[model samples]
Every structure is written in structure tokens, then in C-alpha cells.
Target: MALLNQTQVTPASFILNGIPGLEDMHIWISIPFCSMYVVAVAGNCGLLYLICFEDSLHRSMYYFLAMLSLTDLVMCTSTIPKTLCIFWFQLKEISFKECLVQLFFIHTFTAMESGVLMLMALDRYVAICYPLRYATILTNPVIVKAGLATFLRAVFLIIPLVFLTKRLPYCRGNIIHHTYCDQLSVAKLSCGNIKANIIYGLIAAFLIGGFDILCIAISYTMILRAVINLSSADARQKAFSTCTAHISAIVFSYSPAFFCFFFNRFGSHVIPPSCHIIVANLYLLLPPTMNPIVYGVKTKQIRDCVLRILSGIKNTKSHSV
Candidate 1:
């Protein structure tokens, strides 16, 4: 459908440009991407299994960690397979409906991850600042409700993006200059006025990312104050140590995300398109790939449980042989 007549016609499919200048290197590139995807899937799955089946791992902190792992799993899964197909098989075309579906999952899970991080911060805050009430404050029922609320908030904020993108008439060419379909990326393909799309995208990002960051900051601030006042050096060290993994997770998850978000909108003139695409992919891939390793190394309980599980398996195998 041509835009020559000023009559709007939606393209049935959009062509994803896989790493604009690095097309020749895509096969080589997929090596690391595929590796990361495999690690992310396996590590997150292990975390979920441990948290679900190990009775000792069922605290509020681990519950929030499970949610973060689940979110990372889905977020990476939703994009990487198709991305690999695009890179290795030259499968660049995604149906319009499929694009919208991908956009929904990508954005929704991104928001949900932020929410989960905020919840984790809150968990640490209560655990450190109000240790006496930690159990009562973050009971299983409360955790479930918090999880539900986080999910609902993400859904409520992201559904409009689907509609907004769907309503845009794709009179422009159907080629998206990236691996996967994102709201702003897809919106850029439309010849229609996209002020609303841009505005709403910024607002949603601000509300989800900004609000969550603020809450996490406040939680940590209070946690720091409480830790400082603790008389015992050991107690203070323990409290800060418990939060290290969560803090690392937050930094790994948000830093790339915010960089890509602002860079795409403002840094295009200064940054290469390839760099943007690479960062965008990393924004989804890095956190999932790193979170498990970070937590497994930082948290003694998780590390000990994993060691026990591995030893039990080893013993079973030796006996069977």
C-alpha cells in the first residue's frame, strides 16, 4: 500500500532490520546472544525451581526474587528467539498482530520488573528497619497481593500502547530498524501524527521507571538510616550485605534501560544506529543473564541450597551407577 494517495493502509507485516550496519556480522553476533539467552533461561529457571520447591527459600525476599526471575525469563524469551531467527535465518518479517503482542509483553514485563524491584526494596526496608514486624508485614498473603497489584499496574499502563499503536495507520514503509517490535519503534513507522504515542510513551516510562526508582530510593534511604544507627557492626554489615544483591540487580536492570530509552529519543544524532540496537538488545538480555549469577554469588542461602541440591544429585548418580 502506497502513501501517495493520502489514504491510510496498514502493512500486513513489518520487516525488522537486524543490526543495521552489522548485517554481515549477525551470524557471529548470534553466538554471544544465543549464549546469553541460554544462560538466562537456565539460570532463571533454576532460581524459580529452588524458590518453588525448596521450603527453606520461601521468604518474602525470595518470593520477590522469583517474580523478578520470572519477569526476566518472559521478557527475554519474548524477544530473543525471534531475534535469533532474524539474525541467523533472515526471518525479519513480523506480522502486525504479532508485533503488537511482542510490544505488549516487552513493555509490560519491563514495567513489572521495575515494580518487583521496588517491592524487593520494600522487603529489604522492612526486614532491616522493622525487623520485629517483617514477618507480619510481608506475609505470604501480602506478598501475593503486592505481586497482583504490580501485574495489574503494568497491564493497565501498557494496554493503551497496543491500542495506540494499532490505531496508527502505517502509511509509511513497514521496515522497523531493529530486531523486535517496541512501541516507539513501531510507532515511528506510521505516517500518522504520533504526538500522542510519543507523549504517552514518555509518561508511561516516567511513571513506571521514575516512580519505582523514587520508591526504591526512599526505601534504601530509610534502610541506610536504620543501619547506621545500629550499635553492632556485625548487625550493620549483615543488613547491608542482604541488600547488595538487590542493589546490583537494580543497577544492572535499570541502567541500560534508561540509557537506551533516552538515547533512542535524544541521542540518535550523536550515537550510531548500531549502538542503539546493541544497547536495546542488551537492555533485555543483560539483567536476565546477570541476576541469577549476582544473587547466587551474593546470597548465602541460595548458594548453600544450590550446593546441597547438586550434592544430592551427585550422590544419587553415584549410587545409581
Candidate 2:
């Protein structure tokens, strides 16, 4: 048995379940998933193209938005492609190293998104609370630096995850109960001591998540305080309008995130594994699908640019016809 166990050794591939206990509805569920992924990719690409070319949108806010869109794009591309494959093609076997890479990017980009949201919150707070110094405080160079710094932070924070996960010996079954490779999901498959992995994972998650939530809360609270003090109703309304898109974005991105984090970690006792898996997929997939819709529609500048681009394309088609 020892020799058999030694031969089994470290796994090369893992089996991923696509919405367990709901296999009957996999085809039905895939439709919406495919639609959301399509819209998110198109919308984010359009947003990035617009921001790159449009001189008017070359400001700090839009730049951060571009970062957000890019992060969202990476976020979805990491999981959804494989997820669709599982649902549509039944290709559920993922190589172990590839799984670690996926796990790294997913968690890393998630942290990147969180960091970008914090920067966005800071941008809005400054724009609203202190208009004059906004330009001075968040210059173009500064914005670029912030973006790079966020990327670096995500990379540094997630590098440890790769090592920690790889250190574990997976003598147990190589089956993960979720579609995508997550740190927890993959770590749970190891047969050796995983207490350190679990502890480090929780600490990292809360540090990034809790810290950002606190900072965003502070920034928004201050923003609300400032908005409330404005004398004219129109000015106040206009100021508040700028924040609504961001507020919606924050809600769209984080609500499900925290839910899945807590429920997946804690609710295992009460909830069915299938339900937990579904919610995990929902939170992982929701932000990328919803962010572009929220920003592209709610923000006037991006919306107008998108509309103008569409109209130009239409006019060109007409002329060619």
C-alpha cells in the first residue's frame, strides 16, 4: 500500500465539478453564462478602446476605470472560459500546475480589483470633497504609478500562495468541488497538513478584503458628509450622481464576493455543497459581467462615447451598403 501510495504521488490533473447536484440543468444554465461573458468582454474591450483614444477621458477617474475594466476582463477570462468548457464540452480534467496557475491569477486579480476599487474610491472622494487639489493629488504620473503599484501588490501577495499550495502532498483524491481552481478548493484536496495553508489563506483574504472595505467605507463616508453640506440642490445632486455609478459598482462587485467568502468558509455545515458551489460560481462570475454594464451605462462619458462609436459604425455600414 505504501508503494501504491508513493506511485500515486503528486497528482498531475484534477477533476472539476460544474455545479454539482444540478447536472440536469447544466445546459440551461450555460446560456446565461455565455451571454454574460460575451457582453462583458465586448463592453470592457470597447471601454478600454474608448479610454485609450478619447483625449477627454484621459483623466484620473477614467484611467482608474480602465484599470477596473482590465481587471474585470482578466478576472472573467481566468475562470469563465474553462467553466464554459466544462458545461458545454465536459472537459473537466485540469492539469495540476495549470490549476495552480489559475488559482494564482484568480486570487491575484481579485486582489488587484480590490486595490483598484480603493483607488477609485479615493479618486471620487478627492474629486468631490476637494475639487481644486484633485488634479494636483492624482496627476497622470501618479495614476500610472498607482496602477503599477496595485499590480505589484497583487503579485507579491499571491506569490506565496503558489508555494504554500505546492508544498502540500495530495495523496487524497484529485477532485475539486468547483468549476475553477481556487486556493481553498485546491488546498482542500491535499492529504497532508493544511492548517498553515488555511490560516495563511484566511489572513491574506481578510487583510486585502477587510482593509479595502474599511478604506472604501471611510472614503464614502467622507464623500457623503461633504455632499450633504453642499448648499444648492442641483450641485449636490450632480455630485451625488458621480458617486452612484461607483456605489453601484462597489455593491455589484463586493456583495457576492464577501457572501461567497463567508458562506463557503463557514456555511459548509448548514448549506449543501452544491448550493455553495453555485454561489461560488455566481460571485466569481458576477463582477466581470456586471461591471461593464454598470459603468458603460451609468457613466455619461463612457456611454456617450460607446453610443458615438456605435453610430459611426452604423453610418459606415450604411454608406458601404
Candidate 3:
């Protein structure tokens, strides 16, 4: 339909602004993003290999961890390559279809991450609040089903946005600032009335994104109550400690996202362009980078697995020596 619309009316070419202090920024952005891309990929890939290869890690928590890693990797891949192109190579021109595809994957993976976090919360809730049923309640099949549901639902939910984007006429601006197909940024460029798209986007934000956070909060509420009632100091510490990583992940994932909403909706237009660039990259990059750190810090098993994997490689090379 967007293609049909394009045929009907000639869309104007959008003029793009090179980053201020372009020559200096060219090298500066390159160094950090290059390093971040390496870490994001390496950390996520290492987690993926550990989860896939290790037999002991084949449980509900690791299942969710693997999913989180995969989602974060996708999230990083979608934006970082194009971002590098823009910053280092000055490759800023992206076709309309390419832009929409980027938007879909970015949102799809993010929504799936939200769903996975919700599932993780449920897993914790069941384990802590209903200990007797933990094993049966979170069976292998059940975990797979939860992950599948999260992935499919996220992908399908974004279908409407694709159609909505197809309907809108984009004659105004082709150049998307801040390095990626930010939904709001794209919507702002639409030539036709985008009140419907904006409202729908907000509804999804609050209902799907915001609602997941609420569910997580409620689950933790029950988990905390259960933990407090436990008689053993060791038991309470154990339960609370188990949740620390998940709690940190939840806060980091949701805060910047919702804060972006606040800034976009209420903040002044006078807000610096750097604010947009910084916040956008932070939200995209932080989740994947911090995900490994959270699990590594909070979960001893993952940390051990990471060390074992590294040591095994070292031993292989030592033998070669």
C-alpha cells in the first residue's frame, strides 16, 4: 500500500544534517560504538554458546537468559551497523523499505524482551511463592511454550505498525536523525495525519510495555512476601539474592524506555539534539551489555560457566603451546 501511495504521489527527497563537528565526531563516535558493538556481540554470543552447549544450564532461568541474549543481540545488530555507517563512513541514505524493516525488527525484539522479562518474573514467582509446584509448574515444555508465545506475540503485534506505516505518506523527511528508525521520529516525518499512529503507539507503550512492568512488580510483591515469611535467614537471603539480577535488568530495561516517552511527550523542543542521540543509543546498547553483567554478577552458575568456557579455551591453547 505504501508502494502504491508512492506511485500515486512523488515523495520529496529528505535532506539530512551531518553531525555537528562532523570530522571530529566521525572518529569519536567510531571508537566507542566499535568497542560497544564488539562487547555486545561477544557477550551475547558467549552467553548463547554457553546456554546451548552446557547441560547443567538447561533449565528455566537459563532458558530465559538465552532468549534475552538473543533478543539483545538482534537489538544491537539492527541499529549498530547502520549507526556505524552514518558515523564513520557517512553512509546516511537508507531506502524507505529498509527503514520500515529496521523499525519492525527493533520493536519486535524489544517487545519480545519485555515478554521474556515477564516470563522470568513468573518463573521467580512460582519458584519463590509456590515452591512445592516450582518443578511441575515450570516444566521444560511449559518454558518453551512461554518463550514461543513471547516471540510470536511480539512479532505479530508489530504487524499493525507495518500496515500503518504503509498507509502514511512520507514526503517530508527521509533522513532519520539519531541513527535508527525510531517510531516517533518516523511518525513525525509522515506527510498525512498521523494522529492515529501516535495514539496507537502510546496505547501499546502503556498497555503492553507498561503492563508487563506492572505484572513484574506484582510478581515480586508476592515473592517478597513469601521471602519475608521464611524462618531461615539463609532462605530469605537466598531468595532475595536470586532476584537481584532480574530486578536490575528490569529497572535498566524499563526506565530509559519510559523516560524516553516522558522526554518525547513533555520535554521542551529546546532539548539538545545530543539528548536524543545519547538516550536512543543508551536504551539500545545498555540492555545487551548489562544483561551479561547482571547475570554474571547475580548468578554464580553463569559466572562459573563463563569462567569454565574461558579456561577450557585457554587449556586448549596451552596444550598447543
Per-candidate Cα lDDT values, in order, are 0.93, 0.87, 0.80
Residues 1-321, model 2: lDDT tens digits: 877676356787899988878887888988988898898899889888989999889899999999999999999899999999999999999998899899988999999999999999999999999999999999999999999998998898888988999888887788888889988888787878888888888888887888888999999999999999999999999998998888888887888787778876788788887777766776767777788788877889888887888999999999999
**Cα lDDT of model 3 by residue, 100-196, tens digit:** 7888998888898898899999889998888788888899999888899888888877878877876787766465555777777777777789888
Top-lDDT candidate index: 1
By TM-score, how accurate is candidate 1?
0.97
Off by over 4 Å in 3: 1-24, 268-270, 317-321
Estimate, for each residue in 1-321, the C-alpha lDDT of model 1 and write its tens digit: 346443446677899998999999999999999999999999999999999999999899999999999999999999999999998889999998999999999999999999999999999999999899999999999999999999999999999988999999887798899999988889888888999998998999899999999999999999999999999999899889999999999999999998898897899899998998889999999999999999999999999999999999999999999
Query: lDDT of model 2 at residue 282?
Result: 69
Lowest summed lDDT across 10 adjacent residues in model 1 is found at: 1-10
- Clashes by residue pair, model 2: none
RMSD of each: 1.7, 1.6, 2.9
Instruction: Give the Å shift of residue 104 in candidate 2.
Output: 0.4
Q: Which candidate is the best by TM-score?
A: 1
